[model samples]
Target: MEKADPVLERLEGQIAWYDRRSQYSQRWFKWLKGAVLVAAAAIPFLAGIEAPRLLIGGLGALIVVLEGLQQLNQYQHNWITYRSTCEALKHEKYLYLANAGPYASAQDPRALLAERVESLVSQEHARWVSAREEAKKTLEKLGP
Candidate 1:
């Protein structure tokens, strides 16, 4: 496939980076919560007392709070990605319309416009695929 336009490539890179970072943060939080829960559950066995119950309860509460915060952060990140993607698409459409005649054929204006629109649509689709692949890789790196 042809290389993506530089501007689009940069935007995609930024979005991918942000997504990877968010996923990493989420994974870390999950691991931390799991570790805490495991430790809490083991406390009574290790201490030979009823401390496990208290520890587990406390850790559960902490996990709840952490989950809430993580959810909020994910929400905010999603908003940012949504806005950025929309803005980028809008700009692509505008550029397509502006250069329609030049990029394709001026002899048949409607045909040229259609061709430009198709090209932009294809580019957008490819970008989406690339972004998704990047996200999948990042998620994989974070573990299952």
Candidate 2:
């Protein structure tokens, strides 16, 4: 028996999406870095024990591959970016809900909320696109 608010719905949905992505990226970044550290730390120990050259070489390659994946996918960047967006969105939501900040002076607070929410989401999308393009350019610069 309650009417749903589209603006609030959008705000909440975006918050959840960004938060989820931030957590996911953070987890992946940390996991990949951890793997690289472990592999690297093991290399010296293995070498000291006179392990096969192939094994040591493989560990070095593993470190490269893991670090490359982290750079290419930009998990750390995404984690920070998404987390910032999520926090900004939450700040807007709280302000709108409390009729504080810019919402306080708006005649149509819902419309203002919608506009602000869309703007935040749009800015984030633009940043995401830029990040992809930057990654592409970096790859190109690296060449074959």
Candidate 3:
């Protein structure tokens, strides 16, 4: 009987969670973007048909709100970051399981794997913070 390593099991669970989260964020972003585009495109047709000004205004307002929601939620950014972290975790898991890469000849494989996982997650968080800061600077440059 093969002994089950708890570290590997925990790593697998983390990977699954991140993968699911990433997919949910991506799906939400896509549906929201599609809805916004459809609404925007309909504005011109509604104006041509001499639709009620209120209706046209409502559509424009809806588009702006949806876009604001997208920006505030940062769905695309979260999806990419989560997916990237998940992939990195999977790679570490595989290397440890196969006894390849840095995992090879490790005195404490479990500790090494855990450290690697932390490093990968920390790097992802740092990258996300940096990206947000850069975006804020760009927005500031563009003015309100």
Ranking 1 against 2 by TM-score, winner: 2
TM-score per model over all chains:
0.36, 0.95, 0.83
Choose the strongest candidate by lDDT.
2
C-alpha lDDT (0 to 100) for residue 47 of candidate 2: 97
lDDT of 3 by residue, 3-122 (tens): 987777778888998899999989989988999999999999999999999999999999988987777677898899999899999999989889999989899988999889888878
**Measured by C-alpha RMSD in angstroms, how accurate is candidate 3?**
2.8
> What residue pairs clash in candidate 3, if any at all?
none
Point out the higher-scoring one by TM-score: 2 or 3.
2
Q: Rank the candidates by lDDT, best first.
A: 2, 3, 1
Q: Among all windows of ten consecutive residues in candidate 1, which has the lowest summed lDDT?
A: 70-79
lDDT of each: 0.54, 0.94, 0.88
Q: How far is 121's C-alpha from truth in model 1 (Å)?
A: 1.0
Residue pairs clashing in model 2 are: none
Q: 53-86, model 2: which lDDT tens digit per residue?
A: 9999999999989988987999999999999999
**Model 2 C-alpha lDDT versus the unseen true structure:** 0.94
- lDDT string for model 1 (1-144, tens) is 886565545445544654565466556566655765775566556467645666656666776665555443443344444445445545544654576425444675445445544454466556656666766665567664
Q: Cα RMSD for candidate 1?
A: 12.3
